[model samples]
Target: MKITIAEYLLKRLKEVNVEHMFGVPGDYNLGFLDYV
Candidate 1:
C-alpha cells in the first residue's frame, strides 16, 4: 500500500499520541497547515 505525505504524518502523530499542533499561518506553512 502507498501512503500520502499527509497520511504518513498523521500516522506518525498518532503513534506519538499528538492530539494538537500549534503554529502561526504563513505563506510557506499554509499548504502544510492545510493538510493538518
Candidate 2:
C-alpha cells in the first residue's frame, strides 16, 4: 500500500486525537487538503 505525505500527516493527527483543524487553503495546499 502506498501512503501519500498528506495521508501520513492525517494519520499522525489522528494518533494525537486532533479532532479539529484550522487553515487557509491555498494553491500550494490544495493537493494536501484532498486527504482531509
Q: Positional deviation of 3 in candidate 1, in angstroms?
A: 5.2
Question: Where in model 1 is the C-alpha error above 4 Å?
Answer: 1-6
lDDT of 2 by residue, 1-36 (tens): 998999999999999999999999999999998889
Local distance difference test scores for all models = 0.84, 0.95
Q: Candidate 1 — what's its lDDT?
A: 0.84
What range of 10 consecutive residues in model 1 has the weakest lDDT sum?
A: 27-36
- The candidate maximizing lDDT is 2
Clashing pairs in 1: none
Off by over 4 Å in 2: none
TM-score of each: 0.60, 0.85
Residue 4: error of model 2 in Å? 0.9
Q: Candidate 1's residue-wise lDDT over 1-36, tens digit each? A: 997787789789999999998889998777777678
> Clash number for every model?
0, 0
Q: lDDT score, residue 28, model 2?
A: 98
